[model samples]
Target: MPGRRTTTVEFVRGSVRGGRRRARSWLPSMFTLANMMCGFFAILVAFRGEYRLACALIALSVVFDIADGAVARLVGAVSPFGLQFDSLADLVSFGLAPSLLVFALFSDGRDSLDALGWIACFLWVACAAIRLARFNTTIDPTADKRYFTGLPSPGAAGVVLASVFAFADLMEGRDRLWMLLVVLVPGLLMVSNVRYRSFRSLVSPKSGKPYGLVVTVVVVLVGLATVPTVTCCVVAYSYLVSPLVVPVLTPLGRLVPDRLKEVLS
Candidate 1:
């Protein structure tokens, strides 16, 4: 009787452990769902003519998208399920939502440029899909996660969002040609091989350099606060042009030590 009781207790404990593991696996998916929900809401709000608020929701979706991965890693919940789910959420949040924002922004133009704007937005969605598919199929476990092979969906969406926010009022009366360029350039870059800094290595918790991390984050936040439009534009455009600058600065880069160059880059 005593042996049977002990056996039953052990069985219950094992069952509970299994339950906890399953729960952890679903945790990241919840964040992914949150991301999708934000994107969906952004679309709804955009339909109601709340463009600024809709863009803000898309930005919020970006936060949820980031948190899902971070939580998955922290909880040892990384799985193929989480990866696929994240990609799908990204499609809606980064791909569809931004395209909707673009359409909403230019829908009233009623000109050839507006038609061009719509085409550009459609191209962005296609590129985003291609980018995600390529990323999933070619994910190299040993590859440098410090730099993405091309512009990420979130970053591309961010450029759109920041542009909308910065020039929401001015965009109406301005030449829509530049608007076409804004929508098209980031889309093209998504499908290109331009390397963008990932900033993942900078915030690695295992780095044992929290002071530097905190300082870097504070500096960025301060910059964002001061002249946000210029700061956002500079940051986004810098990533776009960084690859070009690398070759031009090769001579100066040669003067820096290899280790320092790696860190700076």
Candidate 2:
């Protein structure tokens, strides 16, 4: 009887351990799902004419997207499954959601002008898809982790979200010719050869200075709360132009090999 009790206890312990391992494996996927839900709901809200709320939801999706990657790294659960899932979620959140938001903002869907708006939005979606595919295919473990080959989809989305949120009233009143520039420029940058820095490198598990990063993030969050529109616009546009400015304003360009420089520029 005592022996039977011991065996049962061991079995229970083993079951608990297995359950925990399964939960850990699913953690990143859970976050990715949250990202997808935010994007999906954002699209729904955009169709409902809640543009501000839709923009906010797309912005919230960014937090989930970042968290999923960070959690995967923290738990050492990085897998090809996770990578593919993340990309699909990003397509919804960063690619489709933003494009839909922009279309909803600028189009009434019945005129020649609206037709032009639809084209611009479609171009943005295509660029985002191409950008994400290139990133997945061209990932190099030995390459400089500090930089991305093109503007990230999330960054491109942020540019659109920020601009729309900041100038919502003005854009509603004015001719939306400017919307073409906003959509097209970021779309082009996504597929461009320009190299932009990855903030991930700064707060990576390997980085010894995560505390400084945490403090900086807290400060930025506070700024976001106080002046959400201005802060978002500044951060989004600064990231967009950083690649061009970094090379000219700093000596980093000189460090690039001749072959790499051609591609980066």
Candidate 3:
């Protein structure tokens, strides 16, 4: 009887631990689902002509995308399922949603784009898909963690969001041709070999004090609060051109103090 009771207790404990693990695994998926929902609604709103709100939804999806990865890493729940799910969610949020936004913004009341515009928008989706696939298939444990092989989908979509917020009127009227550049340039960069710095370290630093990070975040928040449109525009476009600019600035990097570089890196 005593032996049977001890076995039963151990089994019960194992079951309880398994249940907790299962629950934790699902938490990251919850955030991914939220990200997908935001993209879905962004599409719906974009069609309804709520351009700003649609952009806002896409921005929110970016937040959820970041959160899901961070949460998955935090809980040790990173899995193949999560990786595939994240790419799918990214397709909806960063690829299709932004492409549709471009189409909607440039379309006349006919709910369609000219051939050039249509191709430009479609290019964004195609390149984003290719970028994600390349990332998955080329994963290397020994590869440098600090750089992504190409422009990330989120960064590509950010260019669209920033353009809409900063220059909606100009894009809608006299400078409408510029919108094609906005979509096309980033879309092409998505498939290029140009490396973009990954923010993983900034988001989840493995070492050192977080005070510099705190101050940086506070400054960014203040900029967003004070001049959101300009701030977003500058940040997004700067990143878009960073591949070109970074090479030129590489030599200058040594002039910066090590501590500041650590925080910014």
- Total clashing pairs for each candidate: 0, 0, 0
lDDT of each: 0.82, 0.86, 0.88
Clashing pairs in 2: none
Q: Ten-residue segment with the worst summed lDDT in candidate 3? A: 108-117
**Tens-digit per-residue lDDT, 1-265, candidate 2:** 9999999999999999999888898999999999999999999998887888998999889889888999998887899999999999999999999998888878744456887788999999999999999999999999998888888888899998888888755764346668778899999999998888885774563654355567667877998999988888888898888876766778765676887544323
RMSD of 3: 2.2
Candidate 1 lDDT (Cα, 0 to 1): 0.82
Report the Cα lDDT for residue 246, model 1: 70
- 89-155, model 3: which lDDT tens digit per residue? 9999999999898778777434334677789998999999999999989999999998998998988
* Index of the highest-lDDT prediction: 3
The segments of candidate 1 whose C-alpha lies over 4 angstroms from its true place after superposition are 225-227, 246-265
CA-only RMSD, every prediction: 3.0, 6.0, 2.2
Winning model by TM-score? 3
What would the TM-scores of all predictions be?
0.87, 0.86, 0.92
> How should the candidates be ordered by lDDT, best one leading?
3, 2, 1
lDDT per residue, candidate 1, 79-153, as tens digits? 988888899999999999988877877876666566676788889899999999999999998988888988888
Compute the lDDT of residue 145 as modeled in candidate 3. Answer: 91
Better of 2 and 3 by TM-score: 3
Q: Could you give the candidate ranking by TM-score, starting with the highest?
A: 3, 1, 2
State which candidate, 1 or 3, has the greater TM-score. Answer: 3
